[model samples]
Each structure stands twice: as C-alpha cells, then as structure tokens.
Target: MRALDLTLVLTNMPTTTTLRLSFSPSPPRPLSNRACPHGPVISQLDFFAFLNRHGSFLTPLSCCSLEVDRRRRSPITMLSYDSTSNVLANQFQVRELNDETDFETILSADGRFSVCGFGSLLSERSARSTFPDLVNFRFARLNGFRRVFAHVTPVFLERGIARPETKEISGLSVEPCEGESLTVTVFEIEKSEIPAYFEREIEYRFLAVLPQTLDGKPFDNPAVLCACYSDEEFLRVRCKGSKEMFFQLYGQYNIDKIWQDDILPCRAYLRHCVLAAKKLGDEVYDNFLDHTFLGDRKTTIRQHLATKGSGIMEEEPPESLKIRYGG
Candidate 1:
C-alpha cells in the first residue's frame, strides 16, 4: 500500500480552478437521482460508462484532476478505490507513485473525508481475506471505513472485479448493503485490556459495509494501516502483535477544527477503529438503531438461538453489549 504526507502533497500541487466548500451541520441534503443545475452529477452509470470506454477506472492520482474541472462533460475519472485496486493491482504500485497523484485530489481539493471503503462485495471480500481475526471473532468487527481528504475527485464506487470466484474456504460471505454514517466504538490503545489516558490511546470503530463480497472464506492474515492525529502530532499506525505500531510521520494540521468541533473528532475516532479492524480481519459489529450483531461472509445474526457457524457472531443479548460497553 502507498502512503503520502498531506503538507507536501498540498504545497507541491498547482491550483487551477476556483473551488468552494460548503459544510452544513443541518440535515444532509436528500440524495437525488436527477442532474444538478450547477453541473451533471456523476453516478454509477457515469462511472461504468468511463470504464467501458477506458477499459479501466481512472488512476487514483488522476482522479484529482478530473474533480477540479468545473465544466466536465462526460468527464472520465473514478472517485472510489473499490474497482481501482484489483484493476490496478499487479499493474500499479502505489508506493512507486508520487504523492501529488490521486483521483480524489483532482475532483475537489476541499472534499472532506466521508468513508470510502464501504458498500461493496469485492472490496469487503478483499478486506475479509487480507485482514486479521479480531480477539472477539465477530464479523461486524471485520469491517470499517476511513476519512480521506482529496483535492481532486472522480466517480464514487468505481469498478474493479469484472469477474467473480467460486470457492468457500469457511462458508462465509459479507452481504451487500446501503451506506450509513455511524460512530466508532472500538479503541486500540498501545496495549489491549490495559488502561491508559484517553490522549495516549486511540479510539475508533466501523462505519459501513460496501455492497461487495468474496467467494472464499475470510483470510487469516490481513494487514491494517491507521492514521492518527492529536493536537500535537499526526502519524500512521501499523498493526502488529494484537497492537498497532505508530510510525512514518504524516505531518500535522491545525486541530483547531478537530478540537473546536465536537462530531468531527468522534467521527475520526470511529473511522480509525474501523480502519484498524479491517487490517486485523475482524468482522465489524453493526449497530442498527435497535440491535447489533456479528456479521460473517454468509449470514446476519439476530438471535442466540442459532449460531452463524463462522464463530464470527456471538449469541449474546443486547444488554450484554450495553454492559461491556458501558453505554
């Protein structure tokens, strides 16, 4: 996987068009399928149209440019990395690419990191196969999303797996679902089951499962990467021995937004938890308004009466979760 510094990335890039950022704390604008008056909205159909013409989704770095084009008509860059990973897997090495390149940066440099790695079968399956097993062995714990800030932008949910596999290693499969924004509950401290100051510890949890799936069972070895920021520093934390190690300084941003804001920090912490869980290969626990459970490759659990068999779902009551969580 390739990573870059945000400061150098922003400074080295040349600005082209004027960009405007709007943050509305009010209820989110209802999603519409219609075209926007300002410009045509890019949808899955538009994304696939570009794929049909180009043979592959736009490169991650290239997405930044497409996003900045104010008068894009039938513009051809992809926004999401879902399809891009497999399409570019052997063809591309992220580490070899320069920091200034990416699809999202080209779209809107001002785009806030709303979770990207959600809502797909292929991406979820890749995450399932590549991540590690959580100590609790739950499926909901297996997945999560991250906040990515990109100046450039492209189509969301880009295409990747034009094909599917036929294997069942553990009879597990992550089903497809719609997107939802939720808070993070899990925390990866310097050590697990040990107490520490909240500042020294990292808090996070999963966001949503992209509508993608894998054929084989979840993989035993999954690598997770974490980006952490406090008022003092920003760093990447790599998972190792049940705990993630922090390294590779990613530079810093004014926490003024983070500290002055309430929901942003909470959301960031939740995103961190999910990102770590994805690396760890643990199933994420989805907290629907009324219930929660451990999801596996094949099943969604509702009761303790029946076990999902992946050992991913726990047959525990909701009260148990409340007690363990103290919420």
Candidate 2:
C-alpha cells in the first residue's frame, strides 16, 4: 500500500504570509531526521501537480486535509507519505477498499448521495440520452418499493412513480410489501455526477435505499428510490378514474400530437422500455410488469400491448431514440 502525507500550516497574522508544507516518508523517524527526495520545500503549484500525478495511490479521504482557525479564519493543509519508489508495486487495491459496509458508510455520511435509475434510464438509449456521463450499470433490486405511472409529463401522458403507498390507491406506486423488490438498473457514478443525475429527475425525491445485486449481496454504493408521486396525488388520482378508464382516455389521446411536437407518447415510450426489459431476459421483463402500473392497473406486457393495440406502436422511433437493450 502506497500512502501520501501532506501538512499545511497557516499563521494567525492578518496580512498575507507564505504557507509551509512538509512531505516525508512514514516514520521509523520524523521529518526532522530525514531529507525529502522531492526536496525540502515545494510551491503550491508544484504540490497540486504532484497530487494530480499520484492521486490514485491515496485513499479516498486521505488525499487532502483542511483545518480552519476559527479565531483568525485562517486555513491549514497537511500531506504525508513514506515513499513513491515502491508505489506501483504496492498499488492500492481499489476493489478491496470498496467493501460494502465501508462504501455505504462513507456515502451515507454525505446525506446528499444516492444512485437510482428506472424507466427510460433502464434502457441504454434513453439512459445515454439523459446521462452521458454514466458509464457502468448493474441490475439491482430495491426492496420495499414498487413502480407506478403517476407522473404527468407534457409529452408522455405519464411517467414512472415510486413511493410508499397502500394497495387501495393506484397500483403504480410501490406498496409496502413484506418481501417484494423492484428491479432497477443502478448506475455506478462519481460523487460529482450526482447533481446532474438528479437534474433529470426533477419531479422525484431521493429516498435513501440500499439495493441488492442479483447474487443477493448488497451493492457497494449508495442508492435511493426516486419517487415521482406523493400520498395526496395517489388518492386524488384514485378518485378521478378506474385503471381501465385511464387507459381508455390515454388511448383516445392523439399519439401524433406528441410526435409532431418532437416528443414521445406514454405508450410508445413504454414500448422502448419493454424492449429494453425483454433484452435483459424474461426475469427482468416480468419483474418490470409486476411492479409498474399500466393506467390504473398492474398488467403484464402482453396484456398491455393487446389492450392498447398497435396504435401505441404506431410511431416507430428513429434509430437514435431506440435503445439497444442488454450489455
């Protein structure tokens, strides 16, 4: 294991002063008895450059240190490491460091961290369209949550809704089930990408969730259930129409209106989602249907297609809008 140590000291003086940095190999002895191979002192610019070059060797929380003097409002920095000579040979084991508990603990401490994706994000084309920075994704399941079609978008009549609700309301929101889990494609993203990720889910709220991998182990990252509906909305929709009536109304809406305005209808968008799930194999497709709401009811993909008819499939999306499902 390669390690880095840096120390920054600031003075209490009000006027500007030079910041001092000390870098040394780990002790058998302290810096007083040793000579820094890089040199005794380095400029702030050089220090940043060195960090850029060797940052991967440092642990997640060990790369930098900042201390502020409340009295003077001054800052202090620190860095320390043994030697860079054997760094490559003793390179850090990233995977080992990413153990489930530790990874979850680190992210949970930040409070504002989460990784969650369903609906169009489950499809490669839609995901890529929305999150260009997303690179790796895994099939995971969120327990105690379900999918619904409650979010009303201008283009698509409805969007997937995930929230805690009772079975008596709309069947779209995930009800409090004892053992059921909602299937989702969880993306592994850098901490910096979080803001942009939530940007696409503006209507949703992040509910902390710990998703499990297909093999049943906890995924080694933070996740959230992105809920697009609330308790009030669920009850309101329930009073408005039955599931069959909702679909009937949806079917009568002009699909071309969406296409002419360069948008996708709810059913057409759903076709892409179904195709993506089918590509993931039977288990995923079935889980998707069992969890998601079609109008006011929960129906299988076949039933949805048969009832909605080919009109929902009328608008063939351009290749760019189509998703190539699976890895």
Which candidate comes out best when scored by TM-score?
2
Error at 26, model 2, angstroms: 57
lDDT (10s digit) by residue, model 1, range 69-113: 222222333223234232223132111001212222212223311
Off by over 4 Å in 1: 1-298, 303-305, 308-327
By summed lDDT, which 10 consecutive residues of candidate 1 come out lowest? Answer: 150-159
Question: Could you give candidate 2's per-residue lDDT for residues 217-246 as a string of tens digits?
Answer: 655544655553332322334224344543
Give the number of the best model, judged by lDDT: 2
The models' CA-based lDDT, in order, is 0.23, 0.44
Please give the distance, in angstroms, between residue 316's alpha carbon in candidate 2 and its true position after superposition: 1.0
Model 2, position 20, has a per-residue lDDT of 40
